[model samples]
Target: MNDKSQLVFCIGHCRIDPTDNSITFQMQGCSPFANETTKVSLQPKFIEVLSYLALRHPNVVTRNELVEQVWEGNVYVGTKALTNAIWHLRQHLLPLAHSGPVIETVRKTGYRLLLEPEYEQLNVLEDNLKIIEAKLDTANRHMQFILLFMSALVVITGVIVGVHLYQDNLRMIDTQIKVITQDPGSERYPRLSHNRRWLVYGASQPSGNKSLFLKDLQGDDLPVRQLTSLNSSELRAVWSADDSKLYFASHYLDTDECAITQLDLATNEIHSLAPCSSEMGAIDISSDGNYLSYISKHESDKNGGIYRLSLNTQNAKAERLSCELTCNYEDRDLAYSPDGKLLAIARRFSNISEDIIIRNLNTGEEHRLTEGLEDIRGLTWAPDGQRIVYATENSGSRNGFIIDIKSAQFRSLDIDGMSYPNSVSDKGELVYHQYRRQFEMAYYSLGGNVPSSLFPLLYSGGGHRNPDYSTQAARLVFVSSDSGYSEIWISDIHGEKLEQLTYLKSRVAYPRWSPDGLKIAFIAPDDSHEGNRIYILDLVNKNIFALASGYHNHGRPTWNWQGTSILASTSDGITEFYLDNKSPKVINALKMGVGFAKSSTEIVFSRYDVKGLWLIDLNYPNRIEPFISDQIFNAGNNWVLTKGGVYFKSKNSTEQILNYWDASTQQVTPILKLPRSSISGFGSLAYEPNSKRLVMTLDGFPQRDIMLLKHKLLQ
Candidate 1:
């Protein structure tokens, strides 16, 4: 064998028969793997983190560095956590003799890998069957010319398609586009007239280039006009009581911070209020325009939170509305009730679900009107001002609810599963947006039930949270806490049999099938921590459980290079430590930046977080690294890692573009930009190596989208 083929490695759990050099696992009962399994488990995330440190430095990687990756920088009490994870790894692997070299301590630094990696060139042709392919071309004058021709065709053709569809969309809106202006794009937050007959939105068009515009909501032929414009000025305006004045924050680049500017809507005259700039949070004025309240994020004292600014002195009298010891509470969402006696504000970043909180000015006491909402993004007082309406989400389903100010009873508003809700009427009429399959729209209602299509199609895959359009891209698999409160469930793309996979009394998320389609590993509710833990379930036996006491939050586990034992894990709360515990210690953790060239090692799903999405090599020892690291949130990679790289989605601005990251270079480059939305939610991935098709899901207006991207890596 040539010495150049020394990249393959196995420390403890890996075994290679001399005759063929095919990898083998030491685990006794584990079954074999197939070439098409790119969807790996969650356990490997923990182990993958550890392997990165081992491969990158070859020596001890500081525990602090390791903990940062695992704990996400919360090193508060991490010393003890690191000790436990390492202790478990040593206990499990010491006797395996498979861990190529021992993990040695460097006194003060970190741990190190002692042995050399052990080997042969992988044949890429073997995995070609698994890929759903497209034409291949190298980047050059030819490819660029083809791309240019396609771009021009799409622009001309896509516009034609867009205009035809947009006409239909306009009709469905039921409300006319009273004003369509080429907006300046940044100005005041919009507020409508009390009668809901006119519209107000930030207008950043030419002239002031930063102001407001009004639209006749009565479906008129009125042209859009800039209501408030100031030369080279930046402003954000809201509605003042009486609906005669618009209040906004402005930045006087030359003289002041973003200050509050009020415009007499009746006269079209602007008033540059002192000290009310963009620096201060949103402000709410009294019904009589006598008193005003806004958030001052620059907390001067523990008690100085929501403040009242007087027009006379411009002096803000501050009061602490919440305590932050137990939860992260920030001042926001301040609004004036019709009576002007009650102030409604939303507190965010609090560990507990935030909500619409009302304060009685006279009593200086506050009360919460909403609860159990993971996020109370925004709030507003109803026309009657007796209720506080806000948006919420639970287990990925977006909805809105209104709370009775006096009774504190939450009446869930029957809007489509939507977001960004705001009341648009004084007569109890509500207008919000719901996502359709391809675009978003402004929906309207009169104080009651939401409108439903005569067509009964579920936009969000029937509320199936992370819908995967199957490996064959024919069916779907998603984990829904909805089934008896959030468990792993599989269904067809159109919502067929809602089969349950676990009977455990806890939640199961992030499920993945083995290459051979015989087993799955999932993140489940830990009987110990009551949080997430990794569990392996054999589909054949169905009764057995493989729990990883070694790692906590053992994310979705993936099979290792040999498919012998899973690439199990342990983490330092921040960084993941890859351990091939087929028998004992980590058999052989792969180098930091490598992927399998073998057909069988394509990563099932490249998982991601703040840092980025990662690609894994399955056919070898666990080697994990970043795949795409842009702001591409909530996406996964399904690939057939045969030769050059695994194919997945790359973020091209807000779009999910088809791209291939080479296994050899560990570098990703864009291939085709997918205009279609993804099939799964953020981070959901389904790849059929044979078909070479990758399916992903992403958030879209009114509905989540499942996207199918077909590609091939001929290079």
Candidate 2:
């Protein structure tokens, strides 16, 4: 193996100090006294693969060699497993690769370590300690006596400070939280004025229109005044410098237009300032109140990007902040730094993955703050501007995390249902939005005597979604979080004989049954949380294995008609997986494949950089055209393809409607209107061709409100 002995003589074992427990992997050229170091714990398999590659440093090892050595020649398991392990190992090794990739991949050959491996050995630590002990007796007696005296004094001082710090940390960790608004409707994106007395938020009414409401936080029993009565939705509001006006995005339903509007709190007059996005994205005002920023996409652009407009200049157009390098993804959910010098934004690389990034407004410099996160709902800067608190969703659960801007250190706030973190007041009070939601499967029939009725398909709770029905076996499979964790579940059509399949406690979603009904395929994050990958379960043997698609992130998957291969969306695009092949084939590298048509000659899909649904005909694969190009479709996950055409969800001014497009006639018709108070809209749509039965997750007893966090740490 390319002179393994050469590495032994060149760098020795990876020398990590025994006391440094925070460090998992450390490489050469990284100084111990550096201002910051990347600390991450490595799994055993990651270390083994890394050590093997290091032994053959600067030499490409074939794929077969790795499978034989690491996985004991089980190519079926090792093929995609090796790719996943290597991808995660690279992420952990990123901080050390200042010059280049520490592990280099030779295309079509294999991977090799570019840097020499140095690891700590047990014997090395013992020998170093013995050497230090031997030199201790050579010191003078007087100097030794002075050292002992100082050591004892230092110990005493450390104990006193340690106790005080411990108590302070306890208070910060156990911060007191209270629900401020308990309206029956959903209230979202609360904004606290600079004076911390007035709070404004968007409240979803029974009519399905979101209106701005103002509340006096200082008065406990004061009635909240309705701020706006427009027929549009007001989202993501920010207070002016004097707290006399509010700036927010208004999405008009009739004209399908979105604009930045200024609301005079004193006179209750609303005026449109400039055009914005209708996606309920983000809006914020600079600390100095001279500029207003929001996410918008012009007619010429494909995706939303951060745009800034000058409030001081009359009729000033919104300028798009072009991201030439770092801000390359679709940007949303932004907050201005307290000093207005930097902006923290959530950068979405795809539907399933995004992370937090900071940008310098003047110099156009950017730095990534977080990585491998999913569904970043909202983020806000701390009052002092030294830290940021952002909320993200995994499966059905919501979580909050706080990160220090300079040090890049982050920790979970241990708060549940923290959807949109709006603001943190200077007086150590925080206000945000929390949605109390429970999703259950709803069933309906089209032609039967059901009379367009809605009934619960399943009895249990905890967010049931992504239902798939197998006509052959008369079985239905879906994802549910009832066990306090998202897991795969299966039952009959009537929701009887419910059996829990996998106990993977992590987030699981999008379970699809094979055509034969003998197997099921789903997507979940790997152990390292790299990204969601596809896995298959055999009902006959009760065994499970991952379907390696050679990509890190994967979305919803669909089984082909024959059930020999599966199609899914990954980081590369649409990929097809086979039962025997170790490598998957990428069909379309530009679009995300949602599902396959009945004849298997057409694939329904969407794009990351564009809107609207499109179809790819296998006969002429290069030609791509729109499928349902008219009107507004809610989300990609809220649609399904069937023999008739497509059954999708759309929203009007009052409520969500289920619409179906007829393939034969090429016409769109509204089928059913959903509940008006659905905060978290419908989940994945499922339809069985033979029975003409539809199953979807519906929000039940949806409640959302503004919450206040009283903590010393907020200050």
Q: What's the distance in Å from true for residue 438, model 1?
A: 8.5
Per-prediction tally of clashes: 81, 5
lDDT per model vs. reference: 0.47, 0.73
Global Cα lDDT for candidate 1: 0.47
- Measured against the true structure, the TM-scores of the candidates, in listed sequence, are 0.46, 0.70
Cα RMSD to the true fold for all candidates: 26.0, 11.7
Model 2 residue 455 lDDT score: 74
The digit string of per-residue lDDT tens for model 1 on 73-169 reads 4343244345445543443334444535356667888766564333232243223313313223233557889898999999999999999988866
